[model samples]
Target chain A: MVTSRDIAQRAGVSQATVSRVLQGNSRVAPDTRERVLAAMRATDYRPHAAARAMKTRRSQTIGVVIADITNPFYPELLEAVSHALDQSGQRMILWNSAGPGEYSALQAIREGSVDGLLFTTVTEGAAPLTEALVHEEPVVLLHRGLEEAQCDQVVSDNVAGGSIVADYLVRAGHEHIGYLQGPELPSTAVHRERGFRRRLHQLGMDLRPELVGRAGFQHDTARTLIRSMLHEPVPPTAVFCANDLAAFGAIDGARSLGVHVPEDLWVVGYDDIAMAAWDSFNLTSVRQPIADLAHTAVQLLLERITDPDLPVRHELFTNSLTVRGSTAHTPLDPPAEQRDSHADD
Target chain B: MVTSRDIAQRAGVSQATVSRVLQGNSRVAPDTRERVLAAMRATDYRPHAAARAMKTRRSQTIGVVIADITNPFYPELLEAVSHALDQSGQRMILWNSAGPGEYSALQAIREGSVDGLLFTTVTEGAAPLTEALVHEEPVVLLHRGLEEAQCDQVVSDNVAGGSIVADYLVRAGHEHIGYLQGPELPSTAVHRERGFRRRLHQLGMDLRPELVGRAGFQHDTARTLIRSMLHEPVPPTAVFCANDLAAFGAIDGARSLGVHVPEDLWVVGYDDIAMAAWDSFNLTSVRQPIADLAHTAVQLLLERITDPDLPVRHELFTNSLTVRGSTAHTPLDPPAEQRDSHADD
Candidate 1:
């Protein structure tokens, strides 16, 4: 283990000069920087991370708290974030919050292990943890938003996404459509519900309470809920799912019941995950600008990490509707129209 | 900040006793342990992670190096590993190895910030950084096996899985079959190829060079390669993919070319990922005992962490075939007979 002193001695420079060159300080001459780097390579000098952290008071690390990586959507977002962070030579320490509670998340926040935090909580109310993180370091919320907390957030326009689905459904001549909502507390779920309901009212269509199903953002729960929805005295002709996972469940449920998608019923999902494009699902979904959201969140967090006094920023990217085979048929189609007209409101 | 001294004073115990109780040494009396815990809670005393590391010579943290989380297989493995590590009161520090080179991963290992390393490398070659980890700390290789390195490894039997698929294909009376292979260098890929070839030879069949397509472990690349295979002068009646993602690409490729799955051609994939059961793919794949692999890796790593003198271990788990609609056809079908007659070796 060669030290800075050893490198300095070998390069015929002072230890301070070696440190400056290693840190890429502007004060160091280009020739000196090259010499120091060459000496470091030759000697295999590895800086002690703990010592560096003590000296600079910076770990050059950020914490990413994701609810679940099993969900394809979060991984895509993580990939983008990791790529952006790597560019700045900053490392991301990932923590999975998929367990029973937020205890681990809070533990990570209070330890002062990271310079900043990027949290994607499963629920909308994480005020205590949010406050704790804010007190210790700059916090940026991604995907899941907290309504009561005033924090920097980067999320897709879920409300507009829901409304866009409604618009597409209505244009396809579906008047009585059901909504499969995610967990009640997640802000994205609530906003999407609001948008769906508002658009339904605007279209002069009544939303039937029986037509709605709420799942805790899980595939099995969504499947059970959707299965029951189909068995109702009169099922809605089209169903709008809260997320891609739930949408997949609904599709599976329909298949189990021998219901032909887009023929007997139309299914639409949000968050056009990579699987949505597979030949199996071909799911019609609202594509969240995930890459844009990742870029915005990273940029915002970087700004805050550099200068914590920067005003809190909220970036809401627009969503787009990707039409696929699942929602291909219009309600005007004879059999589908008949099913739509006889549907209970 | 309240320290152990405060807790000792409040609990009427010595500082050593308080430290012992906090460390869960199990030698302390229950009453004294409870008193110390209550006093510490009352005083809001939180242990400093850095100080603890200095005393214990352990960070109580493990580094997990994953190539990509967006890949479904990696997340499943990560979740299991995280859960197992959490039960032992250890934290996992994630390092994404999706960068250009192994520099970042090597930096993490050389720094000694973590107690051990769990790596999931994409490339088959033994990286210099991996060798360094083996020499420096307790290293566990997950999924991807290294041929050169002698270290603890936990992997599903890819060779057995490949053989299972070959057996199924032969049982179904498919004489002409295509094999979609991943990159050549990876151990898993090599093992799968060996198993598939051996099983085919045992069944009195020889692998046709033209029927084998090579693609990196990526869906898009597999899609292109599989498309070309489907357009061959005389396409095989059944195709065995390297993994679920590639199987999905093959399914999509077949659909794009108006080839009906299980009707015109059969498709079987390895690694029965979550998406395999989705309404779209419904792919017949070999189920990798993920939870077992995860638990085994964690247990092996912990043993090494506890005592570095432990010998390196390699655990192999058996894989089961999951039959799905993708390859539901039987040999008695007329299409199978036609395919057998058209086979050109």
Candidate 2:
């Protein structure tokens, strides 16, 4: 058990200074704080957070609310958030919001079990977010943001990502394109669709109302949705899915109908997860710096926790296109000859 | 806003009885406790865990330590544990051990931040486990177990699972087989290998030393390991990987060298993760009842925390095989004719 006195000695500082650092006091010099943190790391110091909580009235824990854990994207985001929180010397309490109605994080924060809350997934106008803000709790939103919330948020430029996919497909002469729309409540899905639709209109390739299909997080749901959309009279030559999982489902659904990817159709996904690079999927996707987003969210939340007076901040990261085998080739012209083969469907 | 009085009125019990239930008092009658709990759930009661901690010296929180979150298996396990804890009216603090040297959970438990610790992954003779036991902190091991620990453990029978795989391969007329071994520390890996080797010896088809290769959780690591093993003059016709991820890697590695799965080579994995059922992989794997294992582990830990005098227990689950497309067919004889093309390696 390393003590504050030992940390002070190692960093050439007084025990009082070490205590101040632990309290997240801004009065401490930056260099001195860094040295103290380094010493603590080197000594494997384990601060008694419970004792400190009693004195500071802060639990030194942050509650992270995730809607789903089985989704590969959430796990990746959680890893990043966990590392970031670990660096801030704060513990993370994971709350799975089993449904949109779950408000476990808000209750946990109100009870002082956690000092702040980080919502990686939340719907627009969520009751818990409104209640948390009314109570003046430290809150930060990541991955998803609300349209009319006065809160700190760290997210990617989802609209621009969707627009990029639209432009890529249109430039490849894909006039008949389809979109997979996710649940309507989340700002991420809404903004993404907004951008995609607006861009396709600008490109003189307005998306057909019948081509837009609804999809959930489940692969089977996406498969059924896409299969029904493709069974229409004039099917899409390319499909832009809301996320990587949706894209995988779309590709498999098309293949089940004997449509060859990149030859008969092209598929694009969002959120370039690790599976996107697997030879099995080889999916083209929009890459958001999830780690950077998570780290920034943690930083903003900690700052708000340390000083409640700080103005709300919205940090947006840029998204880029990651091309892969899914959309490796964009034919110059509509293959009338290829279309003849699937005319029956 | 829901209080003990409201709960008492709803359950038709005295407020004192409701308080006893909130305090986890063992003297409360089982029927009374169930009714009080039902009323609490109906009212969406949020107990002040921090305040309760001050009065009862119990945080109503459990610290769960997972070595890696990116592994799909952990997320599934975590979902089950979270549901179980929610039912027990407890919160969960997740600690990503990040590496073997991490001991954050032990420190958190010692400081009364969490009532007990649940280790989903831990090495044999880990220092933190030993110290936690020495300090008498309630602990339970899940997914992985220590050889010489006096702690409650809930795990699937990996030994039997390994033997089943061995028996399957040998019965399929595979004399030359390879094994992809995971990290040497965890009992899940050690015991799995023990059962596999012993069963192979019993069947008179011992695993060759050259065919056994070391791999890690990373897909690329497993790919490189299996590729090198298959590059030998007398490569194996069947390979059993440590986990599903490794099996995917092995299949891809063999395919990269012009060998076909279930034709010239067969691959098997453990854990039977959801990905195993994906069309791209469709891998055969040993299925462990992960949800049951997680729920049982939580129940055991809560019992131990409520009554520290409870004797330690080990709960072992049975494993079954999930046959998929990866092993759809087995030739009547050795695949010598199919192996001729790859013999130059």
Q: What docking grade does candidate 1 earn?
A: medium
Clash list (residue pairs), candidate 2:
none
Segments in model 2 whose C-alpha atoms lie over 4 Å from true places: A1-20, A23-30, A38-47, A98-102, A255-258, A329-345, B1-31, B38-47, B98-102, B255-258, B329-345
**How close to the true structure is residue A304 of candidate 2, measured as C-alpha lDDT?**
88
TM-score of each: 0.83, 0.90
* Model 1 bad stretches (over 4 Å): A1-48, A98-102, A133-136, A329-345, B1-46, B98-102, B329-345
Could you say which candidate leads in lDDT? 2
Tens digits of per-residue lDDT for model 1 on B252-285? 8888788898787888888898888876677898
Cα lDDT tens digits, model 2, A1-345, are 788889999999998788777865556789999999999999998676766677677877888989888888999999999888876667788887634324767777777778888988888767788888998989999999986789999999999998988888876667678888877878788888888989988988888988888876556677787788788888888899988888888877886677878677788989999988876677889898999999999888988888899888999999998888888543344345444543433
Model 1, residue B248: distance off in Å is: 1.8
Task: Give interface RMSD (Å), model 1.
Answer: 1.9
